[model samples]
Target chain A: MSQEPAVIDVPFEPHGLPPSVAGAAATTVSVSVTDLRNLRYDWVASAIPGRLLDAPLPIHSSFYETYHETPIKAANDVPRTIADALRGQLAAQGYRIGPDHADIRIGVIRFHEDIPSAQTMNNCFYNLIPETVSVVAIAAALVEVVDASDRPVFVKYYHAAHKVTPWCSPGQPIWAPSLLSLYRTNLIAAMRDMVGQIIGDSHFQEALAKGGRP
Target chain B: MKGAVIALAACALLTACGSIRFAVPYPSVGTPARTPGAANEIVNVVAKDDRTDPGGAVGRNGWQTLVPSNDPAGALAGGMRAELAARGYTVAPGHAQATLDLVSFAVDFLPNDLPLQASPGAPGGTVIATVGIIVIVRDPVARPVFAHYLQVHAAKPYYFNTSNAPDARTVLSEAMQSAITGMIADPAFQQAARRAQ
Candidate 1:
């Protein structure tokens, strides 16, 4: 029962409507990346390595099981990846970046890759079996469009997903040098895909077209 | 070789598991004494879960963990309704003035390995399970007044054998129940519900 209450607040600067939208549709919109949040939690990052040997293994086996030692690199660098993707997509859509009295502010609310142990070969007895691990990545962004009075015209939530199955067999080394690189590649691809989905949302476009206070 | 095959088959069978049934810990629980004249008001309840498996998860140790019943969202909503009824509120199916949405639920377990030889302050084989919930409440006008995301976690240490360890499903369910109780017991939520009524 240690849960706290929810309190959400956002500070916005006053800026006039975008040049594009006058009557119904706004011709141009300015945007700024307010924040990028990484929500993935990893337990191994703080664990003391090599100390596990002093303790009895969960399951008794002579052959040691290989765990994915390297923390998910893509999860660690999500802010950079999201920032880059957002900048690229906005620039292409003629949205100016920086503090030039933006009409919209974008923020990443959720970004994470979850690979549960039961879904992986880590459950195998001494890595003697093969299993397909399903990695789930979910990304969501919050977009708020404001008028010159700093009043919110419209607010929208955009979400995207990526799922992939990677196989782990008896002979395959879990801590192989290339494993981290592979995970990084997959995570980055998923994040970029979600960014595309968000920026291309029809509702998001309509919000831009009907640029007025809600 | 024969024993190995049997073990492998056992492991596989355990992996391809079944659901865990969780019973309501307390039945006919009375409503909050403070929130009077609240029984006549009707409130709609909606629940949903976005997990890989809603029946709960099979742990790496082949133990079925965090199962909130065959249908968690429905069970949770039902549990809430029962609680509300005890608290003097009318829970209805549709067109109520207020709505409660159990939007998201996630359960995760952390494995712990510790030294077999007991020493001072030596951590034993402990497994920690954490449950998180996101709940939203909207007024009659459909404006959100309360939205909170909270996590409840439990941990138990195992000695030489894990057989004596607590069941993960039971632990997780208890944690979840406590969390739900915390939300409803909040004075702010009580005031809001009364005002809506």
Candidate 2:
């Protein structure tokens, strides 16, 4: 049997970018994000370390079957579809603005949940999600660029959620802005902060490269 | 008088058997294995942890991001079987003098309310989390061969950005992967199964 390589740590490298994003913003860069499962917020952003813009997704509907084992086209259609939508949104915003030398780059990340917590839905808690929560358990990972070295960065992201979309139906086709508009709002705000953090670090790295900041 | 003595003896035997409590039975698969030359010890794993992604610095709507999945018991059992088979072991009901029986396992999500940094109203929100598996392995006499406890800590950046909510799929996948990956990497697990002489 062919075994995979053993996982180990890279001790020489010091800092780390946020795992959920595509890449860091040391300088202006173009990146792509693919949300094949069709997410509402549409994740690519320009964080402090790098910029995670839009990229074509590798979603093949043929990679899967429905929950009932029925043949369905997308391995993760909704998220990937939404990713396409996000790209359109960015282009519409005239994102080609700002400095040519300033931090510009792209990053992409994917998140998934393993199982939804049904029991918690029954129990009442302050921050607990609503009951129709289908436990859209997701598994996530980030693929980014190491701003300091132009190296590709890949990392994992994680979370468990009961609710994915508001239009609660077993087959209603999840990712709807109606259900996620509120969530989308929060994700964008966080992206700005995260991007800023990544970019700031990149600027610091560049300064050292140029023999200290002017 | 004979009846009373018989009852007392039965109670003693029951106590000697050990305690087995399964919090909840969820269907899944896993791999178990027993090291070579260690017939007296068996390490039956129910579920091996999976890997991760990025989402929910703060969950959408300010919900706590990074909640971990509870135990997928069936998966663990299946995983143990597969692992042992790869290692070359005979499975089934048989007495090899000493045996390892999976008595119980539990996975939970509790509110740590623990903050990564700190923020006002951070209440600091609910943490969808996972404390690793509680595996109790018993010897032939039903004594605990090994009892282990672990908590899978998921580290990812998910800020509360009201403008964009994280993809539920992305968040859950990443957290599950991280927790599972960590589980297999744990030194404690290795130590527990290190050929008990």
Candidate 3:
């Protein structure tokens, strides 16, 4: 039997630029962003307790499944997605994207999506059996900024969660949306929400303004 | 039939006997150039796990216990030593001015606020990892110059049967790193370390 790989790399693509300051003119402040995500563990499977057939009850047995069985073609790279999005937003605000000798440096400590599943009552069984599954998408990140001297200037954590699907009955009809598609939707929405929080922070903007100054 | 039932029960017990273990890699500290005088300071670093249950059962998924592969106290100490050394501080025993104690390293799975009824199958929750430490800086005569308690929390979403070892590891790692970072970033801690003889 083949051993399961310790980490499974999932491709991610964040959507368009986060909402920038309306009519906010661009600045000449240059910045560089780094991906500092821990690469050791990647695959976080969503699990649910198994339902016994005879008793029609949930048991301690857990059934685990990944968001994707195999890697999917990503529109943007996995870890780079957040950094790239931040750069894009900064560029929109008229900040120069320079990796070499930038005034402000930002590090992304965490950037990932989690799919949380819960058991709800399914209408199929007259709401008698609490076997219907509901899933939600959650995204979170820890970002830090440093000045030219690499002195820690600011740090903030961001989080966003949204329900992906309502209570889905067990063995629902084939016409329902695929599990992968639901996951993708959740991921995209959560990423956008989280990245938006970072871009819109006044402290973040202030750090950029004061970077590399004497 | 009775014998078959007994055999099945035994199998279940055997499967749940051991915990799922994962190692927490040393957290990467960003930008160690905090204080100009920090490079010359010699910090005697002491780390110990003071938790009552150091068996390392951080959380539970179904019937399985999640634990760290190595001692969490040791890991925290090793990470602290590396971080301090990276900042150009001399980390060694004897006549040390700085001491760190890992009081608690715990990860808890709290069920998320959902409209659905709670059950084993629908166990959706948030994984909250917390790290608590005490930092002490002393004079040459072992007099306490500055002492403070620093605690940090990192959280991630937990999906009933879905969240696994990697999820737990990620949160735990973040908590550990945050604890160290919080300590180093404190203005008081820096002042004490700099004043340590």
Candidate 4:
């Protein structure tokens, strides 16, 4: 007998506060931003940002790639695009952008959460649910940086050049701001001190010690 | 998903029950070549190097014994063979009309799998504090392909005998086999290859 899709409603309630800086004493740290690609997923075409179906690696692709010998500019451009986006968002929020003049540094980092399988995808689309099966959830974390000062400046950046759609055009887009709005919610959650602690502090050290980032 | 699983389980049960049968996904059979009107000769896959077999995945170390693809020829080449063969491609000894060369192979190791909750709350079952694996796959010849890395888990709460042989053997064979099967089944790869000269 075949089973029905379990419809396991994933709980994604708004977790915490959005990222923001309080004030002076160098409260901003424009961060290097990049995305964690979940290509291991089953229907990756839908999981990934459509704009980067053909973008280069490292900068816009996966950590499997590096900027060392790869000629493609998109390799390392991902971090730059992220830094620029965060700087712009911070500036718009009343924080100043500077090479080293900023206080309270903000770091935006994305890590892949899980992978999908073609079997699961086909099942989902066709309404087929297995009795018991495992599926990897496709996800990424967007971190917001805060200054160490008492004012506690909140530096924010909400776009990944890859998801900027048209702007994620690899080496072509040096600075793309297309993500300021769409990822605002996701980034805000990542920037929270409480949750960010998960990424900042040694919250999951046991796992980390067991394996390098997967 | 239920139907597929039920079908697969049924098939497995049938095998377990003594039905002596070999099957491949039907939708994937003879999907046709991409070259439009090319000679349609079988693509050749050559080993630029020597490939190793873990003697069927039973070894001294669970990680080491699992289908050894640590090297390019072993993992990368074997995967290409398996994936392609799964899709009904004949791997020739030498050059046919087209060829697969090991441009580059990369492996990623993840020490552990985090974001874990207490055992009772999640499905991971074990308190496996350390989890990681080596992803072995080939870089796309001309274009960037999706990740084909294999994930191997270690030191988890779940143990069925805890012998490296079964798990390592299962994973290694599955990874290599799937890689080749995937290559054959991918419509996108076929499209790109057809578009290429």
Candidate 5:
């Protein structure tokens, strides 16, 4: 049976803060970004929660291939876009973008779009027939607050996944350009939600306020 | 009429209870034609398959399945060499400018019996094929310029019918083809392959 689509609220209540810079905040924040996802495939598509089942190797008759090679710009371009968006979000929260030595440094740990088939399949088959696609965008980071001496004062990790949908109908194939476009659109929306979640959280706001200008 | 019924019942039993082995083709179509003398940089390609036979899956009536061949590492190395050669890079036996190694090749299926069903076919289940490669680009002096591990994954949905061998062949071929295409299409890969010796 298909369960209802999972609903997640943003800025999930922060767990009690740890000591050291526990109550610190900064006005200037620098962000370090990294892209670790496999850019070859359009997206992670799906990660079955448990162990995968083994099967036989049916593909026989080996042969060579010579095909035109096209660079995966879309996958390469996503990290830059997310970094730019985060900068804007941070600026709006009264944080200045600065060099690596800035008081607040946020390092992006992982960012990708996850489309779970089980969720999509359930959404389409159980809740409603003739279903559309379902996708979740993920953004995770490590936040480090340093004293003026560059000593680590406090550190916290944050990760968020948001469901965004244009729900491609069954008619829309996975490789269809339109589906990729929709996924990109949904990814942006999900990222925006995460930014809002982080900036609006009471704990983060307090951190920024401690040494913040505003 | 009664004979037809008995024959149909027997066929269903064979399909549902018996194991089926499918021979899927390696993806070689649509590869770009060899580029004319782009460069003389030599590249080495090596690969291997890591899936165990009668592998860890349980399908209907204990039906087990496989996707690639017993030795896909050999197949992938051959394919990679051909692809590099077509890109105008000279593939070599040793002391090359770059080496491409196939780290692993694997496939896992959901509802593992997508190609095994009773008389009529019903659509469900997905097959995911994953290929991992490591590219080491070296300068003329045998100095490593860059190295990176690249993995590609392809998934296809399938339906099983009384005669599933054909469907299995098609799906498995497509999955492998997609993976190969994905690997060579990497921007880093292009940059490395096109570098002058």
Candidate 6:
């Protein structure tokens, strides 16, 4: 007799403007300069282990074992990769990157990649077993901004996930190139989406304008 | 032989019923490399259990319910305190510039349909774990400078057993680690710590 999982409502939405800042007047001032700092990146991979269940016919099955292995790797420095892309995007928007005393400051609250994988081991038989592997890449980023006066501006979070098709069927090697390529591709897409959102938001544009001609 | 086969099947079925209790060991928070110019400001850490049932079921399927052997809130707070200390912050009680609240911790299980296989064996399913926390930073005058809610989730699949206690514990621990990691990695959290009185 399994019970229903408890339903607990979170006190607040995952992403939203706090009531105190939601109604603040949009800044009419415009500044063309800004600085980006405090970008951090965390890479988290699934810890689910592979299990081998021996269910033989004509005999009583009583064997079950689990094995752990690292099936994923981070091939590149994601933080630097995203930072470079962001700099180029901001430059195209007519915003100059200043070294110091900028009117506006941009910070990344969260930038992490979660690589979760699942395995399917062909059931039963005797020897010569077959298996299939599936993996998914999920990435999330949270960005925040502050005006020159150090007043809190706004915070926004973005996330995306994509499934990586296994390269070899009968038995795919853990470190297949296809796995890494697709994983990186999806993470980059998430970063692009974050940039697009920041530039497209009217509120963010207004905050940039408040920088007042650096 | 027939009797043996029936007994094996019966054993498997019996194993899947009733309530399963397991303890979630305190997660290990490794020593974080102190960032250059990182503040060592004092931070007050508080924890609360906001779940409707502290001793209630954390996970379940059609056959078994998973319950924790220890307090979820206490486990979360212990992890957070260790992580903050490793990040070069002084974690203590009393008036401080920053306060971290470990609000709620919960876990849920969603079992996938049995895969079409040649024979009957252990089935597979998934478990989703979530952790929520609030970070607040105040100025000398006690004016709130930064406040926000962060929720982190981790979902993983399990095989060889649908109601695997170790799998549930692992996912829950992963979610808890992410919550603390996410908070410390946030630029706003860093700024607030630096600005704390």
Tens digits of per-residue lDDT for model 6, B1-197: 22223323533564665578889768679777774445557666666564434676665533456788898777777887788788887777543545555443555544343222212245555566766565666665655568666767777866646357888788888988888788877887777766764
Error of 5 at A157 (Å): 26
Model 1 agreement with the true structure over A38-144: per-residue lDDT tens digits: 23232111111211211222322211122323233222344445666555565556554443233666665555445444223444424544444555555555556
The two-chain DockQ for each candidate, comma-separated, is: 0.16, 0.02, 0.05, 0.05, 0.04, 0.06
B1-197: candidate 5 lDDT, tens digit per residue: 22223333544554543455444455574757555444555666655333222232212211233433344556556666767777776777553454555433445455433222323445535555555555555555544444555555556765544444454455445655655555566666555555525
Q: Which ten residues in a row have the lowest lDDT in candidate 3 chain A?
A: A49-58
Q: Encode model 4's per-residue lDDT on A3-120: one tens digit a residue.
A: 1111111122223333443342233333444443322221122122221211222122221121111111111233344345444544544444554332323232232111122223
Candidate 4, residues B1-197, lDDT tens digits: the string is 34346434533432322111121111112333433332342444444431111122112221121233244344445555554555554555432322332221112121122212212223322211111122221223322221122222222232322222333333334433444445544555554333432
Model 6 CA deviation exceeding 4 Å by range:
A1-214, B1-12, B95-104, B115-121, B139-142, B160-163
TM-score of chain A of 1: 0.60
Candidate 5 stretches greater than 4 Å from native? A1-214, B1-24, B29-37, B48-62, B95-119, B125-128, B139-143, B148-157, B162-168, B185-187, B194-196
Per-prediction TM-score of chain B? 0.63, 0.36, 0.78, 0.36, 0.62, 0.78
lDDT of 2 by residue, A96-212 (tens): 222322222222232322222222221212222234342232222222322234321222122222234333443333333332333333333333333333334543334222321
Fraction of true inter-chain Cα contacts (below 8 Å) kept per model? 0.00, 0.00, 0.00, 0.10, 0.04, 0.04
Supply the global lDDT for candidate 6. 0.49
**Candidate 2 residues B108-142, lDDT tens each?**
12222222222332232222322233343333443
Give the candidate number with the greatest TM-score. Answer: 1
Highest-lDDT candidate: 3
lDDT of 3 by residue, B104-180 (tens): 56565554442223333454666667676666666676655666566676877666452357767888789889888
TM-score value, chain A, candidate 5: 0.56
lDDT by residue (tens digit), candidate 5, A20-46: 332233466665555544433333222
